[model samples]
Target: MKRRNFIYLTGVGAAAAMLPAIPVFGKEISPEQALEHIDPAAKKIMSDVALNAARSKGATYTDVRIGRYLNQYVVTREDKVENIVNTESYGIGIRVISNGSWGFAATDKLDKDSIAKAAELAVTIAKENARLLREPVKLAPQKGYGEVSWKAPIEKNTFEVPVKEKVDLLLAVNDAALKGGADYINSILFAVNEQKYFASTDGSYIDQDIHRIWPTFFITKIDKESGKFETRNALSAPTGKGYEYLNARPEDKIQTASGTLYKGRYDMLEDAKQAARQVGEKMKAKSVEPGKYDLVLDPSHLWLTIHESCGHPTELDRVLGYEANYAGTSFLTLDKWESKKFNYGSKEVNITADKTEVGSLGAVGYDDEGVKCGKWDIIKDGILVNYQAIRDQAHILGLNASQGCCYADNWSSVQFQRMANISLQPGKVKLSIADQIKNVEKGIYIVGDGSFSIDQQRYNFQFGGQLYYEIKAGKIVGMLKDVAYQANTQEFWNSCVAICDQSDYRLGGSFFDGKGQPGQVSAVSHGSATTRFNKVNVINTARKI
Candidate 1:
């Protein structure tokens, strides 16, 4: 299928899923070849070559990164394997500050001569571009550890798992979906491993091994007589974990009125079966009534809202209008943050931007730059507090150090400010989903993320979900279809009247959150408990369209 058609069918979040064949960014390699590891000492030698070359070329500041990226994908239909892919990319990227401007160059060749040539080229480019600089770039001070290494706490490296095993799992998931009532089903397992080594003019050398996995499927149910159909997508969240994420445990399953929700781990086979059943129910569900009502949003559903509204708006680049060409700028202007009293949400709403949360996609020992990673409050007790900033932008916020949120999708890409794991902190008051639902006289409970659209400014928006259940007189009455909600970002957050406590808190995220001019993707997680918004607008999507 065409790439655009594939993306349209599966949502942009799973950009790599169900493709006939993945575009090879690097050389196609066998799964066994992916297991081979390069010694950190060897990488350090290559990095030193670039660092010295750039300094010799009159670069005031320089950093070198040696990256080895590996990916594996398994795609299956109802009973057959559609595709199996394994690819590897190895390269060195050198960044330099010369003549008060930034320049970068990358080369796939790792030899000392090639590395030095790339470094000198970077410096030359910086000097040529410096003529157009309005002002010299100012970077925040960063104190880095001399030598350090960080690895994901993965129980099993996905590359080590045989391709046959992954194929077996996905085929079984597809079979379960078909057996459960799906007319058509598509399943995929995608795994990524990034081995990165960094060396900078600053006294530091950093080595990091990052791993991520996503297991998902799409199931469709049809009514042959009516020529009507309904679909359900997997509720799994892309996570920065190993294959162990698919090893769902009894405790990982949370039973609720709507259905079973998963936490850190997932059961792909069981979820596919549930999706098959849910799709059939969706086909027969009644259309929702169009009106304002209280809304209870599951974490699986709320994460996208938080990502589009809260996460994007607070990006330092977007706020500064640097992203105006692509995703547009944010409504959360610098002046609002300067006022310090601008209420961004209800008092119960607390949001944080973190890069250190365990199991989060953005979790890292240090950012793409050499700065250490940590967490900071973005919204505190309803007030705007901070924005995600990098080293170059830290001084604008009057901070001495970066928040450690910089990243580049690949070694060939230039590193820039990216969103961290932005999450809504759970309520302090003890509460359960059932208890929270009991207080809502009239509401709709939304589960799983779906189609969403927000203004470029991340203000006004509408969002749809995978499943919608109506609540009446504090009890779930029945399922509802053609459901979506709309509201301004600030107004919606302020209307949050209740949040279930920590026990119900869960994470939902995307493996590909796109940004920048050339369009780079980053993985991020958003955490929240079941939350309630009062008197929000709910629309019947069928009638509105």
Candidate 2:
């Protein structure tokens, strides 16, 4: 998390350099050594040593996090593998509240002597910072569970699976695209396992093992005569699962008019074939006539919308301007939340912030600060109900406990408020994706996430998609090209006319949701059903460009 020089993704492309564009950094480790678990008893002794040092140094409160972070990425283009990276970062981070100020320090050294040194340094920094403090930090009381543990519900550890298996799968995906007529293809598989141990002076010792996976690709087709090209991205979603997620199962597949949908499990090869065909069709799709029309949005597309428009804005830190350094402040200002009557959407709109939903990227038994995870409504009956908060911010909301949303992307990074799995609750009425599509008139049906733009305040926005179909008089007429929708956050959600029933609910996620000034990336998810929004303005992105 503290890399001074690191490469960021320039953009998505099916045809680019022969090698992969991004790099993974952490302590280096071989693939075979990746999934080894840390010893909890050893971690507890380290925690005690650090705690004694901090208390001896006049620190009143302290918490220690010992973590081993592991990540593997496999990249391939066409027939050959481009890059296979395996990274591991191991360290201890200590945070302390002394002299009415908060300070943090981390070190890769795991010995008692080194950890004690880090602990003392944290207290020293806190005392120095106390000189400029105007008010003492106010942390809500927490009840330690004594000693506890949690692990991601995964049947097969992707890290334990042979590297050859991952490589073979990605290569097969690329070959399927080529056989389906894609001019070029690039595929990637990313996996992560976080082994963490948390202990605090408040009397808690918590150990957790977490896992996450993402398999994605970009496929392109070019019309040589016109020298114009189009691209389609794989519809596979990142999930909090294991290698089993890569396995294809008929029971877990949802086949709809939008093509094949997946839940719990995914079929990368099948999806690649669909991506090849779709990108080809995209090249010949009709150009849209820009105007206001209803929009039928698949969960894949709507999830990003929810993440930007609702999830970011409702974060208590963002609304309070604590996150203004990078992601900017919120449009749903604190005053609006206090009113508790601000209409954020229609009566059909019910958004939630959940840290306990199984198979969700943000799902955890307890957050980093040792608060138990739970769920709460963010928007209910179309009204702003709550903002995501941690122990320090809970007082502002007159809450007795933290909302349990605090997190740190790595051991060396200090934990802070991060977005949980923010989702739009499914409609109570019995409605299906097909049923929702049948009601749209003169609209565009969109699938898969694409380019998006939003104001610093998370208000006005524009979004695109991987595939678009013209919907006329309750029927999908034909594929459309060069389409994007423009709307304000509140206006768009208020325009929600319908949301499909729970049966249609599905998840969409991001592996790199970046926030804060120094910047840390967290994986989170957004769940939704096929939803209909009325009379949203459509634009021709190609014409504008």
What TM-score, over all chains together, does every model reach? 0.96, 0.97
Clashes in candidate 2: how many? 0
For model 1, residues 1-545, the per-residue Cα lDDT tens digits are: 11111212232222224332333356778998999989999998998899999999999999988888887878777787877878788898899999999999999988999999999999999999999999999999988688899998889888899889999999999889889998888788889899988889887899999999988887777788976778788999989999899999999999988889998899998898888888989988999989999999999999999999999999999999999999899999999999999999999889999998888888899999999999999999999999999999999999999999999877887899999999999999999889878898999999998888899999999999999999999999989999999999999999998899988888888878889977778889999999999999998888432
- C-alpha positional error of residue 179 in candidate 1 after TM-score superposition, expressed in Å: 1.0
How high is the CA lDDT of each candidate model? Answer: 0.89, 0.89
- Expressed as tens digits, the lDDT of each residue in 1-545 for candidate 2 is 44333544322343653223443657567887785666899999999998899999998999999988888888887888877878888889999999989989999888989999999999999999999999998999998888899999998999989889899998999999999999888888989998989999999999999999988888878898977888888787899998888887998788877688786678999999988888888888989999998999998899999999999999999999887878899999988988989999999999999998988899999999999899999999899999999988999999999999999987888999999999999999999887877887789999999889999899999999989999888888789999999999999999999999988888998888989867888889999998999999999988544
- Output the worst ten-in-a-row residue range by lDDT, candidate 1: 1-10
- Pull out the clashing pairs in model 2: none
Task: Give the runs in model 1 whose Cα sits over 4 Å from its true position.
Answer: 1-24, 543-545
Model 2 accuracy (lDDT, Cα): 0.89
Clashing pairs in 1: none
What TM-score should be assigned to candidate 2? 0.97
